[model samples]
Every structure is written in C-alpha cells, then in structure tokens.
Target: MDTAEPTTVGIINRENWIGALPAPVREAIEARMTRFTVAPGMPVKRAGEAATRIFQVETGFLSLIGLHVDGRQALITIYAAGNCFSETAMIVRREHNHTTIALTPAVVRQLERDDFWELYHRHPEIPEALCRKFAEAISRQMASREQRATQRLGQRIATMFANLAEHAGESVVGGETRILLPITQSNIADIFDVTRQSVHREVSHLKQLGIVDKRHGDWVVIDSERLRQICSY
Candidate 1:
C-alpha cells in the first residue's frame, strides 16, 4: 500500500512510550517523528532489514511473520493500535528478525533510533517504563509457551480466540465480541503448529459449543464466559 498523511485518532493510551512523555517532551519528539498511513497487506519492514526505526500503531493492525526453516511463514506475533514494536532490534542495532505487515488500513507513527535515544536521554523514566513493558511482554510469551505445550487442541484454539477478543476484538450492537482482523485456518495452523484440517475441526467444535461464531468473514465470541472457563491458560 502507499503512504499518506496521518489521520486524526488522538492518543488514547497513556502507557505507551510516546504517551508517557511529558507534554513538551512529546511535542518535541512529535516534531521529529513521521506519521503515515498504509493499506492492508502492505509490508512495513522486511526481515533482515536494518532496524532503523520503531513503529507505533495509531490505528489498525500489523502481523509479524517469521520465516521457518522449511520455507514456510509463521505468525510470530500481532501488534494493534497502541502497540510499539521493533524497539528490541533498534536497541541492539540489529536487523529485524521478522517481517511486519499491515493487517488492515493503518495509521502508524515511526520514531527513528537516534530520536528514540534522544527522548530516553531527555527523560530518565523512559527506559524504566520501557523495561517494565518488555518484562510484561516476556511474561506473556512465557505463559503462551506454557499453554502451547500443555493445552489440548480445542483449549489452545479457545485460548487464541480469547486473546484476540481481548486484545483486538470490537463490540457490536448485539453484545458479541467481533474480531475484525483477518484470521484464516492457515494462520491458525501456523500459529499452533497444527494441520489446517485440525484447525477447521477445532473451529467447528467451537461453533458447536457456542463459544464462537463466524460473521462477516471474521470470528466473533458468542459466549466469552464459556470460552474463558474452558481455556483459561
């Protein structure tokens, strides 16, 4: 997709790196930052590229894709609005480890490495806040790993759904939680290390249990309580 000027979605989350900055500091940093828009399926950063900037999603979603040894793609992670990514690579001055792509039309703000460090030096709290954030991320990763190793297939699928619903789902008129992101059987297969057919069967089971439903080419949580109880991992 092509880039365009930033759209107006005022900052909502105060915990992010940019949001944490004091008003004047934020203004100074915003003066140097570049805000742009991208269309769905557009490439953000390719794997092995020098990580010169970290991206914050003002709106829309980006999926991180990792290349498997067998020439396959794996969904490494998902970043939606209010999320900051590629900071680790920027910190270490290393290449991007995974390719990042827009999952929907996106408004993104990018901060260059030098600018990021400059902000850090300007505010001593920045590094501590960032460290806490990364620590939380690491904790989530550890929990996810544990769940993947021990959970049943159906439970794993349910957990994935629950996570998406919490992190990216939208509320509809009928009170159902709708996940607008593009998720396919192939994506699930790659994420859970299962076959496509297995994902299909598990999805069907979820439908049968009334835990989830398909709507408008996306998935919806029909009974979040049941889903949470069954897949509390």
Candidate 2:
C-alpha cells in the first residue's frame, strides 16, 4: 500500500511536543523546525546513531525496532502522527538504541538538540509539557510490559488489536472499525515473541470467531467491543 506524503495529509491526534507547547511558543518553534518527508518503508534513523535532533510526527506512522545479536529484529512500538521521538536520547547524549522507520510515507518535524534546549529553558511551560508527555509514555510502556508478561497469546493479540483500534481505527460501512496499518504475520510473531505458526493460529481463530476480517490489505474489527472484552477491556 502507498502512503500519502505529509504535505498531502493533516495531523490526526494532537499528542506530540509541538501540540503540547503553548500557542506562541509552538508557533515560534515551528518557524525554526525542519521538515522531512519519508517514503513508505524508509529508514528514518538507525541504532547506534548519534542523537543530534529530536523528532515529532507531523503525518503518517513510524515503527521502532530493535535488533538482536542473533540477527533477529523485534518490533518495539509504533508511533502515529502527533508523537515525538528521540527527546530522551538528545537529553542524555547517547546513541539511539533502536532503529526507527517509516511505517507509511511520513512527514516529520525536526529540531536541533541545542535549539530544543534553548526553548526548554526559556519557556517555563516547556518542561511541564515535556514532563506530562514523558510521564504518559513511561506509563504506557510499563503497562504494555506488564500486560505482555501476564496475558495469554490470544489475550495479548486481542489487547493489541483493541489498542490499535483506539488509536487508528476508522468507521466502516457495517459499523466495524478498520485499521489501515499493514501488520504482517511476521510482525505479530515478533511482537508476541512467538512463532509464525502461533500467530497464524490466533489470527485464524479471531477470523473464525467473527471478531476480525482482512479486507483490502487491512484489518477490520467486526466486533470491536467483543475484542476489547477478550482483552479484559
């Protein structure tokens, strides 16, 4: 599937540093920001790269990935439009631990580390906004870790689908919720830390139970509430 360019798209959720800033500050920052347009499947940043800049999603989605010594790749997380990345890395002056890529064609806004800090110190509200954003990120990370540790494979898949629906779902003709993200079976296996066969079984079970359908290269949740219930809501 092709992703629209950032210039052709608009922000959806307002969850990033850009949106968090007070209006005047946001405008000033935006004036100095540099925009990058990434094509679908493009590599935005790689592991062990210097953290020279902080990034905010202006349009489209990105995936965070980790590589193991055994040559295995893991999917750490997905970031949608209105999300921020690399702030912690920039602050700590460390290389990035994960590789980030465009999950679809994307437009991202970048600020030099020095520029970001200048704003951070100049505006009192900057730290407050960043604190809230980071706090929420940490909370979600902890919750996701806990859930993955305790939940069964099926339940975990359900939870993942439910979360995706909440973040990126769209209404369909028959009251179903559709997610346009391209999630392959291999990706699911990586996320669940399971085998491809296991993913196939669980996905097939979901399809058999009338919970989800694959149509037009995307996933449609036919009964989102039921899926949420399976995830323990």
Winner by TM-score: 2
Compared to the true structure, candidate 1 yields what TM-score? 0.84
lDDT of each: 0.78, 0.79
Candidate 2 residues lying further than 4 Å off, grouped into runs, are 1-14
TM-score of every candidate = 0.84, 0.86
Per-residue lDDT of candidate 1, residues 95-213 (tens digit) = 99889899899999998888889887887766776787677667666767777778898888887788788767899877789988888888888888889999999999899988899
| Candidate 1 off by > 4 Å | 1-15, 21-27
**Candidate 1: worst 10 consecutive residues by lDDT?**
5-14
Write one digit per residue (lDDT tens) for candidate 2, span 3-34: 21121111122356567566898887777789
Q: lDDT winner among the candidates?
A: 2
lDDT at position 181, candidate 1:
84
